[model samples]
Target: MSAQPAETASGFATEGFDPATATIVAVTYNRSHLLAGLLESIVRMDPKPGHVVVIDNASSDDTTQVVESFRDRLGAELVYRRLQENTGGSGGFSEGMRVAYELGSTWMWLMDDDVEVLPDGLARMGAWAPRFKSIQGRRYDYDGSEFYWQYRVSVPLGIPIPFAPAGFDDAGYRPMNSGCFEGMFIHRDVVRRIGLPDPRFFIYWDDTIYGWLASRVTRSAIVNEFVLKRTREIRQWDMGTRHLNASSNMYRYHIMRNRGIMAHYYRAHGAYRPVYFAIGTAATFVKEIIRLVFVERTVRGTSNLWRGLRDGARIRRDPSFRVMPPLEEAPS
Candidate 1:
């Protein structure tokens, strides 16, 4: 774990700053080529992290080789672990963060392998470290245009509210109660306070629930100064409900199940009313039906929707869930 000191007026890091305390925890699966580009961007950061932990979700490709290729170029020590089984994105991050905290990291920067960080990304984020417990960096598509994640979770209705993206450019930091893990910067204490992200979610809504938990305990914001470029284009919302219809069976299952689980969480905690829960659940079911009839033009996917909602209703929280153990060395 290491970092070159930032160039400052005094030619040193801030008085008490120790770069070794920050670790970047990145998760990847099957996209070795994209992973290589992300590592390259990390190597170019003006103020790099002390260490980087890459969690591979049992990718059946040369992902390990991609990490090894960058060992000589990165200032931060690279710790790559390929999981024994595919545990999905939620599991990868859960394990990576646990390893980072155990390594004595005071801060953890979370991201996906599909992003290339700006050269000064960490440097700019480090400036706001004192003011917030967690900070989410801005993101742009491969084309260099900003990605608009305009909707935030409305906890009561268990739905999303469209927020205007207009005024954020002038604000140094925008306060946010929810979280997006892509380019998220968080202090170690917050992790200890809230616990690692839930892996049962498998993929969707895990970060959203985790982010909400963090905000409940301390401050979090979106920083507009730093940037991360997404390597892939998102076609998820291109054809209205067709997007949902086109998703893989696994994705469709989780998309529906996770919402029920999240709704269960909010309701159990008394954050919303029973009436709103009824409305939310009904709305979700109707939307799925619309996709099957109007977009997919087939009834085959309906079984997954029904099964997901059924399982989610009975899915109890696991308080003793442990993150997957880390590897002693990068795999060959």
Candidate 2:
């Protein structure tokens, strides 16, 4: 449960980074069963989190009851909030992080309710906290196979390029340009400086942007240590870039819409070279067409693809976007 504190060089200071200073902020929808398993795992984590907050996105299920059951069993302070409306993953995390920050947590570990953390995962992450502002844990499927989470994006084109399957030495880390929220541990300083994630994303691309923002401000890396295990098998649409082909209409709509919105955001902010903008847009179009024919192989999917692209082109950031208040003060 303990290791010698890592010495700090520049970025995050390891001296003040304590396991007890980290708060686990998990967001869930109607998956009470999965949420229960996740909570159980958190309690068993070595050097457990300082506190835990569960953000329920207006689940019609017994999500509230499940969290209540753990209130007494968990080793840390547990707070459960059920929103009046479903704000999707984007909003749920935004609210959860806000609460964690307000509660004075030094680090917020963001995740969904489907994955279980290894007993020593948090401890492992803590060892590297002094060197990086953001640390992502390695993830594996329930079957014990490592998830291909090392995917990177092209510098200017923004296309996904999966890293080659490889091994890492103990305590080794790799610089990351993108990451998922499943096992992302971040310092409160990054949240305070960069601001909360844009809630308007509703679902997709929000985490990627947040990860980029964190990396921009301070050092970030993916810890090669397997600190978490995914309980479910990887789904078909889980493939990078080919995700649109295997997704439902709703998911497809969001993915396409967010892609365009993010593209414009990056361009306007000069995140990438302007010369490659046309190349990136063209590459995306070609990729979708190929996916529709080979992977999706349905006329209906084609229609949805076109519609998503058409509607997505008009997508813009919500000017009224603001971080939601803490659960206690949230409007009815």
Candidate 3:
């Protein structure tokens, strides 16, 4: 990717005003390899964004230096922030938005660092910006790899479900409640109103909740005309604990607990949502019990199931399970 800046007029007649205003923020945690690949794609953006912020999630493995090396080359166009510890993508993006907003950004694009960006991703998104208040997301070459948890429904359940308006069906994705962080481009005004991604959800389904929140603030659409390629298995939550792994019982815990959170938020807020979460949780618990008893593979994973059961039984109060680092507000 080339870092050639588009020539903006310079002189007293041209007040350092930049008309091409958009910012893309990529969030990463220790995946310097993925971060470098995504950065190369940013350099190739045709109508490149005014800036890109790489929010490093406390990566211990040289990710800070990797991004710094890139910024040293890109200068003001690429700014990097290294947090003290990994806060998952939710915390990374929350802090990332804080950083992007300070840089005079008019719009923000949320993406994960471990991916290949579509050369025209931002340009096409910018083209559609005038049409809607927000764009949900789209990923390239998707064969259901990462995680496609479930379908989304806009408006509360008791209320009639609304259909996507004209002009979005061609994309082949339903215009639903929310979207993931993959390639969602957010207009700056919405962020000012809705605030950042909910950090209460440390790891699971936070995007779904965020998408629901985004819809309340603005009319949204899922755009797949362009896409990003991510090389991971997508949503590797409940990944069995192994050496050198950041395993958290929170994966199961959040699934169990967040179901209650969603239920309270939407059902009380009156979406008449399904108990599908409850059903899934119950089924998983039964399977875990069977595995532990029959297959006889008793490991920390069993404890994870126990955590899920405990949290699910009392899901109301178990909101955020993360320990925040002592860090300053995002730099202005």
Candidate 4:
């Protein structure tokens, strides 16, 4: 795609900021059906990405064949890697970003296999490239309603700013202290400064911490433009202002277990609030319990909550837990 000149004085130079310099990095595990839809959406992107990197997490399905079916279909270069074991979303994204960076991509668009990019999604996000180093476009749920939680992130509480106005500024963007990897369009410099998403998380909160770290070094924000459409359908509880989706037992466990990882990041960044985090953690457990009993209509996996909390408390001392360097220090 041809580059457009920056329209504002505060905007950086737009040279080399087009989609041709961007790489779409996606991770999938046994979701060939969903992956095929995402790949098909890429085939329809207005200005295609420079490269497409798909990290297969050892799926015992037709994922390889599905990706192969699109080999010659995509105008952009396609690179596929199938790991021997399932390393989950964190590992897949880490490896995908590493490959994209080594490929010399100026921008890396990170997402899962479940969402399809809008035809103009890449183009719309690119329009803001000259102004923000880290950017996230809007997303639509399966029913075509806007995903409301992508607006603002409260770095101190380590969650989306609750009850914050969902509207964007007059500039059509809202400043964000956190990021969602689902459709995050980030510059290479941010990656270099913050390093890849910590794989130890293996599932949840990795994106939150990664986005928070990116915010420390750049103008991170979520633009008021829809760029992705989620294809997966899940039961959601509408709370008037926000919606809480039902989650799986595995995700519930990670949501609790990963608090230690979040605490580590917060402490590393000097933003850890023991009292506040503890309160928040307690509140989260209560909400999950309610979701299980009422929304999910079962209490089968309640034990995971306690087990995860116990593991989370002890995880800080685990020798394998990674401690990221300060943002000022360049990534090793």
- lDDT on C-alpha atoms for all candidate structures: 0.74, 0.74, 0.61, 0.85
Weakest 10 consecutive residues of candidate 2 by summed lDDT = 321-330
lDDT against true structure, model 4: 0.85
Ranking by TM-score: 4, 2, 1, 3
| Least accurate 10 contiguous residues by lDDT in model 3 | 8-17
TM per model?
0.83, 0.83, 0.70, 0.92
lDDT of 1 by residue, 255-332 (tens): 678875676566545685667766776677777676666655667787887887776665524444333222233235
Q: Model 3 off-target regions past 4 Å?
A: 1-19, 72-76, 141-151, 154-173, 233-250, 267-302, 312-332
User: Residue-wise lDDT of candidate 4 within 1-332, one digit each (tens)?
Assistant: 56665332323234535677999999999999999999999988777889999999999999999999999998899999999999999999999998999999999999999999988777788888889999989899898888876456666566666777788768898788787789888998888888888888899888888888888889898888898999999898877658778888898898889988898888877998888888778877887998897778899888899988989989855757666653346646
Candidate 3 C-alpha lDDT tens digits along 1-332: 32233332221111222325678889988788888888887666555677888888778898877777777444238877888877877788888888888787877888887777666566556555666656755554334333232235533331112233323355544555676777777777777666677665666656776667677768777755555776554322243221111334556566555555555455434453365545555665664455444444345566776665676556544455332221234235
| Model 3: lDDT of residue 176 | 55
Clashing residue pairs in candidate 3 (N, C-alpha, C atoms within 3 angstroms): 140-228, 146-234, 156-271, 157-271, 157-272
lDDT of 1: 0.74
Any idea how many clashes model 4 has? 0
Off by over 4 Å in 4: 1-16, 318-320, 325-332
lDDT, candidate 4, residue 18? 68
The CA lDDT at 76 in model 3 is 37
**Deviation of model 3 at 277, angstroms:** 6.5
